[model samples]
Target chain A: MKKRKLFILIEGVDDKRFFEKIIKPRISSVYCSINIDTSAQTGNEKIRRYVKSFHKMGADYIFVTDLDEKACITKKKNDIHRKFRVRQDNIIIVVKEIEGWYFAGLSGKDINKLGIRGIINANTITKEEFNRIIPKQYESRLAFLLEILENYNIRAGKRNNESFCYFMNKYVSP
Target chain B: MKINKLIVKNYKTFNNLNISLDQFNVIVGSNASGKSNFLSIFKFLKDISFSGLENAIQLHGGPEYIKNINTKGNKNLSIELNIDFDIQPRLVLSMKPDDQLKENERFEGLGMTFKELKYKFEISFNSSRKYKVINEDIKFKGDLSKLTVGESQKIKEDEFHKGSTITFSRDPSGKVTFKTGAIQHFIKSMKHTQLPILPMQFVKVKHTELFLLEKAQELGLSILPPIATTIQNISSYDFDCKASKTATPISVRNTLESDGSNLPIVLKRVLNNPDTKKQFYSLIRDCLPFIDSYKTRPLLDKSIMLEVKEIYQSQYLPSLLLSDGTISITAIIIALYFENNSLIILEEPERNVHPALVSKVIDFMKDVSETKQVIISTHNPEVVKYAGQENIVFISRNKKGNSIMTAPKNNEEIQVFLENELGIEELFIQNLLT
Candidate 1:
């Protein structure tokens, strides 16, 4: 088989770190290579042209967005297509927000250590919700996120969130 | 005094580059495009005036460190400045109180008049890392008023040039020339025994100091000292907030240090002045609203520390407890408002400052520029946006890796973007300014 090239467009630095740290290590294919960039790095207005150019270069591309206020994944994908004209298959929507994925990746012991006392549905958590629940020990939101990233359990992430499971099934798992 | 033009040759990232300047300037460039190098030129001139030529060279990392590696010719570096003065040189005012009358009489006796001065200095190095001043020149130009009969007779008897221009030049061979015969005669009559030793002059070097400022003073020219003083009055700063947070001794408050280590002492001095204190407090309230008031206290060790009182808290927070951004902002305000210099050069004034507060700093800088020339180098798009196209100088590199500088207003493409209502910051972020 010919070698495959892939380009993934993310919203900002946090998403770039998420893909680089979590998703990149799980890719076991010997015939494929991936490049990740953020809209912030390549200005937000120019991302459409960037995706189009990469597509013309015979590289597969993914445009990742958050299903923030949208009703469903289909509505969010349609909104992204209106701006970037990306294909439906290449649009990956994180449920509610990417912060949800950070929570989804934490083990039960990590959740208890964080002082949350109720049942957790990681898919529905927003950034504001995560900020409200962050323990008093961390000084900043970035500090809390960094701690979560340090102790992240990918197996728990796949088990807790359907969007993360679907992404792994499509891109990472054989 | 204002520097109207700069012509540099074989200096660091500049290889035969000439650029015009204004009272307010914002230099923007990509990383490693020589924005810092451009600002360093002013600091280098300042160093040369205060320290000697050899020490200035060593301060900039020795001879070989500054030579342009891309130059295809001999390793010779030169910088020339064309300066225009709004007021007369007032050389007597700067003299000692006792010698002011004598210096004023010396100026009156010379019958010298000039509105513009051009000074150039050049240096070359051999392969052994030894450097020598190869050339130095100063030319004065002014309007010629009608001369009295005695003055005309004096000019005629001395065989001096009749035009309004006076020229002074010295070469590496210790050959000095003057367009005016009387000044030439006066210089020759001075004792060469009092001349300081010219560094790196291993054998057969007759010239004393490499700088013409010292030579002019030694010759009692009464013209070059004030001009050199104008050039020496420039101060460049890249404030180090960490160093600034320490308590500084009260005795070292001559001027704010380049790293802002003496911020406390300077702040003490600033608060003592009622006019500057009012302005400082207003700016502090606008820039940092959380701080309600500030105080400076003296320790038994004769050191002073700065503290700020928060609106929500009753006690004042010491400098050690303050954040880096707070100290950085405070240092910038004091440097801009308190210190007086002919030119002020700041490198990344936005460093450690929040994005929202950067516009306030740039606004203050713009206001300060109206009184004194202000030049800054920044990577912040907010600076590019607020500085406007007319004040922005874009620096980029060509294929050979030589830095090229151009004003953004002169570029037609940028003008078109501006006409279409695109923000300058957008153009900068999209990499369209280059």
Candidate 2:
């Protein structure tokens, strides 16, 4: 008998985090024998490539992606299903928005009472500086970054912060 | 050519896992045993394979957002998909945050790599990762990398090339050349079709479902269309969708863009092209029996505004005159009327269409998929049922939130239970298993 495999996908870590922090601890036993994973798009060219692989797999698979940041994903997922002949239930997704992000900033009584920290952990301008391009809320990302730095433990010698500096380096001289 | 196997390590959902697929694999689990997340790997690898490590991180929002946080510390996420394309070609991709730090987007820089055994291709890079093309192999492969860097150099088998990596082909001559840019192009070919989706700040109210319908002609993995609608008027310019919100008539003009955004322009050109005007009338009649004969009288040609009338009632036009599905249908007709092999990817084809028309719309898609690959991403069972198992692909997430084709059981009990609960019909076995 083949060991059944499972694939879980998502747009960001929020989904992974929430499920791990909130969902998993609750339903630890019911879901088993499931080899699961999550991922998001790198970009378009790569998306097509993966779609091809999924089709070639010719087994049951699922694809979770957003809709309409550029155009609709309706066709892309469908194309994979048709080519691979996978089951419809295997292809699931949250429609146009990221389902987990909504859970990130969730407010009101439950949040305050639960002692849930805000998802955005870092607030430094360092994040935007690395993009070479920047979004308006660069400072806001600090809330998210601070959490990252705290958990990551950056060492001067052990840590090479190229990704931390890529966009920021654009404006600053070496 | 089916994927009967999968192995993953330190991925988003699984710490270490392996699984096999049934041809018609239906992954049914509680809301979040990593169902949706399990299915995300394909999208992730697709983004990376087709674009590169850099673009994949950006499209995914950021690298911090991608790395799995479970089990402590940073772990390299790896993926291997064994595919049988007549001959089995194994594609493995792996990545993690770059050791170097930058900014949020750039600070989220990652090291991504791809390995395809068929082509013996392997490419890897990070925020500062660059390829040092070997000179020896370049001569044998021909001007593959010359165009990328704009300079070429010579190096003996014993000598190393500066800024250039050395390549020694297996050919008898033992030629010396640098690596060709073929790796880049091969990776670039891995693209996001059916439009890539990024998490938005908000949810959409009237969100569209990208439904898969056959063009009734396409048979391959490609997304080409089966039929092309020939429009009589090519020079009519753009289309104007002047129909109102409450109750307005649909108007067609000279040309309509594939998205049907040009309905407004089509409304403007109705006066010049009688056939277009007639077609517009017929469409209104089919969609809105309340709409009688209507004419496009230019209120302002520069602004591209027109008046619509139905004998008893006359009103200024807006998109609201038609129901959401009616507009979509009109959009489909208008877009299809003039396009060729240009595959139309609809988001939620079931939306707005009456249940009666839903089946027809699907039939239309079935016809289209024959000539062109009509790929759709939908959760609606109706759409799924319409396209049949052969056209449906279920998506879910794993615990760590990586994507997978078949739902990961995490263990044996869940798999047995799912099979028992879902009743993997003998019919399903036929579709998914050989």
Candidate 3:
């Protein structure tokens, strides 16, 4: 039997790096038979425009985006589902922001190693607030964050960050 | 003959890449992305046949510079070409390491190994780097089972060769008849010491063969003539119209040089023919409406000067005084109109011309491509508008910095963008095509 081809389209470089480096290594063995590919759309609007075309080309897709100001995650996913003919389960919306998820995953020891001296809460932390804890560079803050995560060996998933782990196990797993 | 596919390995910027060729191909890419390297493959083959492998490699800055830096373990560079004729035949050439050459050898050239069983030839090199043919298997195409017992036995006996394949002599008494004309012509062409077999060489061969040519029409192999003609007719032009204005010494050259240094001489030949001159004038007028006529005059120094006349002016102005755009446009028109049924590769034809006239230049190129093959490397998006998405091949660098060639049909997102959202030029401008 042949496994179906899968393509995952993400919002920006940060989302792409997280999925490729962090989540993929953990679940790749389970879906080894399927051909999986990833591409970054650079913005939310580009993803919305290209998602339908990608689906028409006989590819199952997993779309990942950050819910910046949306009050409810379900509402954002439902909105995307209505606009495009994508399945509801295929869309993963990071709650509050992607940086919030990173902050949620970091422990006290990891924070000290990352050179942060203050206390931070994951649920309400904005991107700006996270940047204050660990200053983000102009080039790419997510890339810097990803490097910190790898260096500290801080695992990111359901146990560490609730939304990220839920999206991975629900949509990305075999 | 038409080339269907090319597979290159360990070549500069192309580490294991395969490209498909069409009648008309326009390669688009950023600088240093390997568009010029792709076209150089044809020139390289012609060079090997003309000057042998060693000189060709030397001309390209030696083996170390030509091989891809990213290649691991194997240093051998190989190129395989699939050509389409009545019967398809593939030609493979591999460049071996020079260390294999014997210590006693004086001439240390690049070691080349070639094989083509259909042509009954296998070429290798000795320690001295001199070319040697190890095998020459001459057999007819089609069904061998149809041959009689005597014919089959005769062919088997004739297949035994212990010397150079080029020296194979046919026995008159043998029952097996072979098509040897094309191969003979190829050998004769190779004997001439030149970097590339030019158009004049083909003309000389045709003139000499017209008298002794037996079997009248089909004496030679069917594929060789077309292949040789394509090679002879292959012309590349990087126009320098400013240089065209200066008086050039008289020369008996028929084809235009890579630089347009021989422009006046070639244009003089074109003007001598009534039909070609009329076509040339019309093409030039189409691109630049203000031009009235063109003529050449002999200078006191026994050189020739090109002069052009405007519609309102009575006196003719020297071609040097013409605008750069006009001179460039005229040179291109002359080349396209005069070089019939030949492959012409142009580099950046959009330079020094008005944006509006760029489409006209592309239209002329497309029109000529109906009878010939035209490959252009360009950065101008306007050329894409006229050439369309199917004719364009995007050359881009991968993550590893190696050049990757892709057509719109093979890239899903590009295909979608062309189908639903925007034209190819629009996508290119938006950086989506890459």
Per-residue CA lDDT of model 2 for B1-434, tens digit only, reads: 33334566655555655665433333333344454444454445444444544565567655444545463654444444443222222211111233532232222111112111111111212244232111111111111121111123331121111222112222212221223234333334432121111212221211111011111112221211111111011111112333322222344434555335545455455535778767756754665555555343333323443334554666544444544665566555544343442333344445456765665666656655444434344444455445554444444444455434443334232234234332222112212211
lDDT of 1 by residue, B1-434 (tens): 67879999888888877999998899998899999888888877877778867777789888777877788756689999988776744221111123433432322222334578889978887888887778888887754332222323442112232435567677888677666434334333421121122222322323424546544554556544355688777888999988888888888955899999998888887888899889989998889988787788888998888898889999998999998999988988887878878788899888898888888888988888887788999888988888878999888775477787888888765565566456788667645576
What residue pairs are clashing in model 1?
Answer: none
The regions of model 3 sitting more than 4 angstroms off are A1-49, A94-174, B5-20, B28-34, B64-229, B237-335, B347-359, B378-385, B392-434
TM-scores of all models? 0.64, 0.34, 0.58
* Structure candidate 3, residue pairs in collision: A158-A165, B120-B136, B120-B137, B181-B220, B182-B220
Q: What TM value does model 3 have? A: 0.58
lDDT of each: 0.75, 0.37, 0.60
Q: Which scores greater on lDDT, model 2 or model 3?
A: 3
Worst 10 residues of 3 chain B by lDDT: B207-216
User: What class would a CAPRI assessor give candidate 2's docking?
Assistant: incorrect
lDDT of model 3 at residue B198? 20
Q: Evaluate residue A80 in candidate 3 and report its C-alpha lDDT on the 0 to 100 scale.
A: 74
Please name the candidate that would achieve the greatest DockQ relative to the true structure: 3
Answer with 1 or 3, whichever has the higher DockQ: 3
